[model samples]
Target chain A: MHSPGDKDNGEIEALIQMMSRLPGLGPRSARRIVLHLIRRRAGQMAQLATLLASVAESSRECLACGNVTQSDICPICQDPSRATGEICVVTDVADLWALERGRAFRGRYHVLGGSLSALDEIGPEDLRIPELINRITDENVTEVILALSATVEGQTTAHYIADALAPTQVAITGLAQGVPIGGELDYLDDGTITAALRARRKF
Target chain B: MHSPGDKDNGEIEALIQMMSRLPGLGPRSARRIVLHLIRRRAGQMAQLATLLASVAESSRECLACGNVTQSDICPICQDPSRATGEICVVTDVADLWALERGRAFRGRYHVLGGSLSALDEIGPEDLRIPELINRITDENVTEVILALSATVEGQTTAHYIADALAPTQVAITGLAQGVPIGGELDYLDDGTITAALRARRKF
Candidate 1:
């Protein structure tokens, strides 16, 4: 039998459970969010439900670059203007979106989905590395910028991609390592400081 | 024209905005949650959408005590076994839920929705104060425990309720203020320490 003073029914309990599974939310925050949604069911909650349903039904991985899209070919891959010879490769769609937010890179992106992890037994075939290589020849790509993270796995994936695409004779480069725009030298890690000093330009 | 590298469509963007509006979630966490949902669209995302829709359609405020329920009266108000003649008055449903979780309160609850605030121009009519007063006579309630916060507004509301029910000859009480369980004396505020000292009891 369901308790009287606890949650109303299984539906509410199930909703809270699902919400708590989200990346940053916990049980407490999930309960608060559920209550907030319940109070605004006629307006914000209804809209959110409709949007979630539609987005779930329509969203898919872009066939070209593994980025999420509502269609087989994402807008970036279909756009002629974004077909610059440079393909900035990233580890996930989030990185692609982050670079897009910066609005610096005019070329398209290749989302690898994840880094090369020997611990997890993840290999090149698991990621979109092969598809990235195919694009180099098919799209007449000039540069393959490795915009991967500074982690060991990220560097390993970058090296593996560079080696895989060496036969294509494409101009491959990695993002410059240095202090962040507002970073303090006192808070800098040893590796970042070393990289910044070694790559220091005539300022 | 829609940007190529930004979010795929307005649905995803709208979903992110709605998620961000949730308590404890910001824009960055919302984006992360949206991406997570999109990736698991066939399973978790679809389930959440369906649950949200069903819950929104079914939920309503309990007619008696103002607790959230799927019917006219909440299960707590409906249960005859819970008619202990003690109505625990709380400032919000969240507090009621908290007390219920402790499993210490055996009686029904009266949710005031909010505490009285003179600055906010909220009066007795603004909350469920009148309904709470009616429950005292209608339910043969003996003790009305004001499980409200220790804030100025909470104390003012408690005092007003006590005065309102004074003519009825019903017993009224407030929650004892003290240092919380597992609280350290050094970290506690002066007001809490003073209250705890005044409420000292024999071990």
Candidate 2:
């Protein structure tokens, strides 16, 4: 037989379970956030629910560049001002967002959706790699900057894309390897230190 | 003039802002969660939105003990098996949930909503202290367990309640101070170690 407490309080428990599944939230933090939301029911909770629904309904991958957008085409892909003939290729939309936040790159972006993973059985078609190559020719892209992570899988995907785009003869570059801003050399791993030393520029 | 990217993406930005306001989530993590949700729109995202809306509409504080419930009275208070004439007083519903998870305490609970804080100007009347005293006589409560935190405000609230319930001559108790299971002595702070030492059992 179901316990009285368990039977009657299933909704709250279910909400907690769903929230706990979100990235960066565990069971303890989920409980705290749920209670906090419930207490602010009139304001934050209602606002959050509305936002979640609207975002879920409206948010979609940009048909052209694979960036998230509320419309058919993401802002960057549609904006004439961003057409600098340079496409920054990133592994995910989050990276695209990060590049936008930096405000340093005036060019557009191509989100790969994810890196190629053989172990996970993910291939070029699994991501937006074919779409990216198609965009280079159709959009008359002059350069492609590979802003992928420096992991082994990231390198493998970058190399595959580079070979594919070699026929197009577009200038492809990866992000510079170096000590990050505010990163101490002593705390950095041997591999990073070596990469940084090799790629060191003259002041 | 609005930036091309910023103007069209207001809804996504608003969603991120609201998500960032949630406890334990910052702007970066909020963006990550939002992106993840958007990607999982067909399943987890829609499910979470539905649950949030339903929980917001249905969940209400129990009229008796202030526990969150779909009904007027919470399950613990309504359960015939829980009428043990003993009440566990907790500073928050999370604590009540934790105690219930232990299953060591079979009695019902009284949620104070929060501890009294002089600096924050939270008084006895701000909590459910008055209702608790009334419950003692109305429910024929035999014992009151103060399962509040070991913070100063928690102790002050416990002492105040102890004094208030003295006239009824009911047995009062607090959670024992001790080294938690799987807790290492080296990792424990001075205060916890001291408390554990003082309350050491002759095992």
Chain A: TM-score in each model: 0.84, 0.84
Q: What is the TM-score of each candidate against the true structure?
A: 0.86, 0.85
* Superposed Cα deviation of residue B200, candidate 1 (Å): 13
Q: On a 0 to 100 scale, what is the lDDT of residue B92 in model 2?
A: 82
Q: Write the per-residue lDDT of candidate 2 for residues A13-85, one digit (tens) a residue.
A: 9999999989889887898899888887767787788878888888898888888898888878778888899
lDDT of each: 0.79, 0.79
- List ranges where model 1 is wrong by over 4 Å: A1-8, A179-203, B1-8, B179-203
> Among all windows of ten consecutive residues in candidate 2 chain B, which has the lowest summed lDDT?
B194-203
Q: Tens digits of per-residue lDDT for model 2 on B33-54?
A: 8988999986888788888888
Residue B139 local lDDT, model 2 = 94
Clashing pairs in 1: none
Error of 1 at B84 (Å): 0.4
